[model samples]
Target: MGSSARLRLYMNDNGPLILDGGLATELEAQGAKLQGDPLWSARLLHTNPQAIRDAHHRFLLSGADVITTATYQASITGFIDHLDVSCERARELLMSGVHLAKETAETFVCDARPAGQRCPLVAGSVGPYGAFLHNGSEYTGAYAQEMSIEEFKVWHRPQIDCLAAAGADLLAFETIPSIKEAEALIELLREFPNSQAWLSFSCKDGTCISDGSSFSEAVQMANRCTQLVAVGVNCCSPALVEPLLQSARSLLSPDMSWVVYPNSGEDWDSEQGWLTSEKTSASISELGHTWMKQGAALIGGCCRIGPAHIAELRRELKGSCTSPSSAV
Candidate 1:
């Protein structure tokens, strides 16, 4: 089976997968100064890999069934410029993002998985083209108008290639802000026939994505992709989840699962990635059941969300998200 099918098996047997909260959130709390860094958390992949691993370990202990890599702001060019390395070396750094997450997940599963439970998944994150721009255009997608489809593909292919080649269980094409960019990504996804990915958008409201395209239209596009394991929104306000999912209900494919992980309520900064916000960490767990009821097969938090929130989320979902064990 392809990677997408691997995820389906887990969801089929284990119910909705519990995704991890923010990597940068944990990193910042650990005293890694991230403000004004163009590479964001990806910089740590080179300077302090153990920190990333430790963050993943905490989320795993908190009951995250899936952990995302710190590649959201990573790109070949960015790494080359920042690290002053050869192109090949830059690729290695990019691939290391997957390696670090995979290693951490493997360690967790070995120590924690009971007889019947499936192993937790490591999702290699592929952030939008705007993320590389370092201007927060990911929230607006204004850059899509400046690049051709081929240009967009050229920009994203390397990161996706590195992550897939590095052995992530699935790729997460997340925080996409425009329909055109989504179109490019969906087309690019077909090239890696054996690889599976989940596509998520950054919405401006309940009705449409950030670039003003209808959310329903984006959902239709996502479900048509043969390699997409799930589809929904991420990095937007938690309040938008219901309206976005409800609007897509009529057109959603039953075979296509929903994956929704929103930010903890804050404005996104281009340079900082996420503005410091006062989030009620408990609110994510408080609202998780409603998202599941709305047809989400996978749920978790985004920016500003941390291990405590994930523990609460797991607690709230304890009845359905039991400790993974084959004995069950």
Candidate 2:
């Protein structure tokens, strides 16, 4: 199906669609070591592809209606610099992420036959440039000052091209920190008129995006882009989702949907590991309802949230809040 048709089918549903949680965290849970790799989960595309597929399958069984690819931190430039692979090989790795997710979704559909489940779609994850830097700048939007629109487009186009050519259902421009990057991505989407995507930002607060731009401005910018199917926040604090959605709703067109996938409310120090936060103390499943109530049409988890969290969210959304499978 085309991207627009697939998105419309879900948007027209009675409730929000469930997206998969953190790909890297799930990979870690399965014993894939990703500590110092700049590519993060994307590196697994080269060393352990089956593990990537396994992660996707787990999310599918957990009732995720959409599964994002492991290409979030993968970039052609990063591959050339870090992995020292040829450009052709780098593109191959990017395409591999799409195929793995696609194959996993197809296999799950044929085997499970779950009730009320539409065929899950694959969203090619297009993470922020700061992600490529591995400096925690993705959470800060601090890279905007050094990056220009042309540079941003040049940096992002190849990844977008590879993902689109690989036949992903939609592009997920996720964890976007600045309005400049959002605009650059929207411009790049024009290079492929048939492509559709969702623009999700990393917010510093309930009302402001990571770069200190108002959510209203970001939503308004997205509203002008024809190829963007939805716009909202991701990789931010769960506590801020409600107000972010409210801000988006106030600025977005009625036809546009909103997506929310926040972290486990933990603060990540580059030196130390994840620190717990009282603000994120509520279970992700509990937060799902509130996000939906605030007009989020797609909901999922981000950092530190794993398959079990997704399973609980699925059960909660399906109105069957029983125990999820231990396999999760």
Candidate 3:
């Protein structure tokens, strides 16, 4: 079955499917050094693939319905420049990210998981063009102003092609910062009609996307694409999730689901790293409840949100839903 079909089936049986938290965060907790590496967790695909697999395993064990691959910062150009590998080798490394997640999911089903628990789906991570630049542009969306739509398509095409060919259940065009990139991605989806994807953006506020576009407009753009099964926000503040979902709910069609996976109520600085906020009020579980109430169909965490947070979300969501066992 196709990814959209599988996701629909899962939602029919379960309430809202739980996505895994930050793979890089979990990897770091496990002592994988990612700093100074432009590829971030993608570097583990080559240096320590087992670490990547182990991170996926932890999220699955924590009750995530979907586990994304470690290909978020990976691209052919980036790989060739950083690792000095040929295009073939770069593609192999990109495919390895999906393979690792798939293999881990299979192992969890066959060996570790309890009876009746379903195998988690694997989503190939496709971070924004800004991520490839190794700058903070992903959070700001300023880079999109300089790049044309055709340039965006050209840059993203190979990465999308690589993930689709690798047999990922779906593509996660996550942390998107602009409507132009989202448009480019929606167009690129036509190149792989059999594949389905979820376009989640990085927001500047509750009502606006990272590039200052309204959330309603971004959601409306994604709603027109049949290949996109879900659309909403990720890697933004958890506090913005409620209003963002409200905006998305207003524009999204009933056929399309909304996904929200925000950070752990912390601000990120490129130099200082993640800065905690004493002023932040809502907990991750509380944000999950609000997101569901606002009509989100898929919920999880992003940066600084680890397996423990996912486990808590699983418990919270399962407890609130009518069919708790259906989630597994």
lDDT of 3 at 237: 80
Model 2: per-residue lDDT, tens digit, 140-186?
Answer: 78899998999999999999999999999999999999999989999
| RMSD over all Cα atoms, model 2 | 2.1
Residue 310 CA displacement from its true place in model 3, Å: 0.5
RMSD of each: 3.1, 2.1, 2.8
- In candidate 2 the C-alpha lDDT for residue 95 amounts to 94
Pairs of residues clashing in candidate 2? none
Q: Which candidate gets the maximum lDDT versus the true structure?
A: 2
Whole-structure CA lDDT of model 3: 0.86
- Candidate lDDT scores, in order, read 0.85, 0.87, 0.86
lDDT of 2 at 180: 94
lDDT of 3 at 13: 70
